[model samples]
Target: MLDHLRHLLAQDPKLAKVGLTGGLDIWLFRNSLKILEWAGSARDSYNSGNTGLIQRQAVRILDYLDGTQYVQTENIPSDIQPILVDPKIARVALLEVSQSEEPPGYLKHIGNHLREIISSPNVNDSQKKLANEINLAINNVQSWYLGVHDDAAQLIHMSPQQLHQPGTMMTLNHMFKLANNAFVGETDPATNQVKEGVSQIHYEAQRLATFDIMACSNNETSRPCV
Candidate 1:
């Protein structure tokens, strides 16, 4: 599933841009990281085979996150807070662990059995705090998953007429700017071509503006705005 998603994104730059703008790409990428972390611990035959592919995809997502200024660290969910706080550690765990003959025991020690570490008699205050933060972070990932899905569903169900409302259009225009910035230098693997991200955004903005005008016109009832 991850491989197919990556291939689809590579083949279609427009679809990739849309996914980024819609927040689906980042959501899936973050989930992939979480799944990779789980699979790393399990190390069973089924999960082990796809570890390399998931790692590569995670790396690509990390690169995109690093390059794009639009996705702020704060925008990422708390569960994946380590990615924002200590990106190097996250990168090493994702990219290097699979290459090792044995499981990366050091990485495993960080979050695995966090509850046990927090409750152990020998643990210090700092260690307990770290364990609590890890636990919170994991919980945050689950929160983000539910929240984003609800938001996406709301947008999906919106009527075209409702979407063309002034406030919604303004919000969309702002989102377009952010998406344009993120996709600025991205290359489409299918055509091996770079897209004019800003230009496309400008065009969309103009179209929206035109829609706003048409919707506000005297013949509003005669012609459908959407």
Candidate 2:
């Protein structure tokens, strides 16, 4: 899915200038690239029968999640907050985890067993203690996720109309500019192509303006306004 979206974004330079599609492309590229990398690494490991690398990939994702679970939204821009807590994004995150080739209610079943371990009379104090700790850890992960799906899933999946909100547009435009500056000298083929496309757009606009001025000078109509 990420690959397909990226392909579409790359296929059209004009989309990069439009806030709706461009903002999504920028957000996904900036944030979700690592997730895609981890999934790819896992696939390669599974293919080569190197289980160690696949285990490492899981560890990397958990570590990253642990680090970002307590993200400070206080410093985030007000306009960007709405996008963070959007319910649609949260649903997408849950859907991705739930449909991971596991049986229905897999995670829910795990949670239920944890509860039974903590409450059953046969369980010893140490066993219950471990269950309590695990339960707390899971709760911490859930709280950390909330409406902030990006912290975990790292994808911003929403409708174009949703992204076209005034505040959202403003925030995305700001993010796009920061990203544009950060990749100013990146040597990747795709990055270079994007830069070239932007340059071409600017050049064409200037050339058209110059032509308009020359035409105005040769015409008897109103003069070119500066």
Candidate 3:
């Protein structure tokens, strides 16, 4: 199966060189990459005198991305490949690279939740230790992410990605389902019932970690106690 995966990338040399790390490898080929590609293309459309035109182009890109979060208009992956390769567009694109910086207390909530998960006896011992580490990493990442966000807010102002990161979108979709299940029950009110779909995703996601710590836990069970 792993060899088959490698062969799939071998088909496209450009894609083959994307060099995705760990789980990120899966998101490299998704549709959101096209948005980044479009942003790079927009650089060509940038006009210092015509900010409105540039904004329109940005909006056009946003229109394509129906469910983006925060909108990362800064420091996108290099492989995303910005389009609209103009200096003005490039400048705008810089600020508008990624999401609108993660929300305040966002990581705190994540840490608290991770602590709970790790503390749960049901999660098992080794898993508990790993969860503790997960909480620590979350603590560090949230701090740095917020700091970058502050810098972006103060000194950086570029065009934001008009679409949701593919990974984020997928995670949101999953949370939406979980939220639908957890809260208000799944009742349809004509148009699938106007539920807090977006909120639900955030709510559920807060409980889950980015990395699936349980992925290989089965090995611990299957292998004999050494």
Candidate 4:
């Protein structure tokens, strides 16, 4: 599923330049950490056995996360470097996820890191702004999810008479239609906000397209699309 999604994004001219966004990004980061934690536990459980393969895989993932630096100094595209280099943004995202009622250890670790960064005197305004944006984006998506779930629960718990009522059915239909629109990149009438995943992809595509046109007008080469 991950590979397929990556391929789809890569093939699109606009989406090709986009990086991770919303729940998908958090999900991948969380799972990557979980993988390392699980591998360590397995190695500990089987001390006598050869765990070199699992250890090596974990090391590679860690290197990808921490070793490779994406910053202003590197060959990374200027448009995307801010996102790639801003550790505070990633930390804020993880912290947001950690705020769940029952967050896991990995999330807690992320929260701690975010706290440290927030408390540090060296942090800059750009980092703080990036963190704020990430948090707001996450909160928007969470609100949409909660609203949709509540509407779904109403359908699940409705009595037979309530289900049969014309008004009840209409309300349910309206709620579902709103959800469908949000799912496919439309603005939610109730909240007046676009769904995060859909909006992120759409915005990136539009931004990239505009950049390409501007580049062409200037007679400069645009970034290659997959």
Best by lDDT: 4
- Best TM-score goes to which candidate? 4
Query: What are the lDDT figures for the candidates, one per model?
Result: 0.33, 0.33, 0.34, 0.35
Order candidates by TM-score, high to low.
4, 3, 2, 1
lDDT digits (tens) for residues 30-131 of candidate 2: 333343355455444444655444444433333322222222322332322322332222221211232342221212323445575456655556555555
Quote the positional error of residue 52 for candidate 3 in Å.
8.8
Worst 10 residues of 4 by lDDT: 205-214
Error of 3 at 216 (Å): 22
Expressed as tens digits, the lDDT of each residue in 130-200 for candidate 4 is: 43343344444345434543443343344445545555445444444433333344566999976543244
> What stretches of model 4 exceed 4 Å from their correct place?
1-124, 177-226
Alpha carbon lDDT of residue 64, candidate 3? 26
lDDT string, candidate 3, 40-127, tens digits: 3333333233333433444334322211332344333343333323222122211122344222122343344456666554555554
What local lDDT score does residue 219 receive in model 4, on the 0 to 100 scale? 44
After superposing candidate 3 on the true structure, give the runs of residues whose Cα lies further than 4 Å from its correct spot.
Answer: 1-105, 156-226
Put down candidate 1 lDDT per residue, 129-212, tens digits, no spaces: 644654444443333323322332233334445544455434333333333322332366899865433223223222221212
Model 3: number of backbone collisions: 34
Worst 10 residues of 2 by lDDT: 204-213
TM-score between model 3 and native: 0.28
lDDT of 4 at 30: 42
Clashing pairs in 4: none
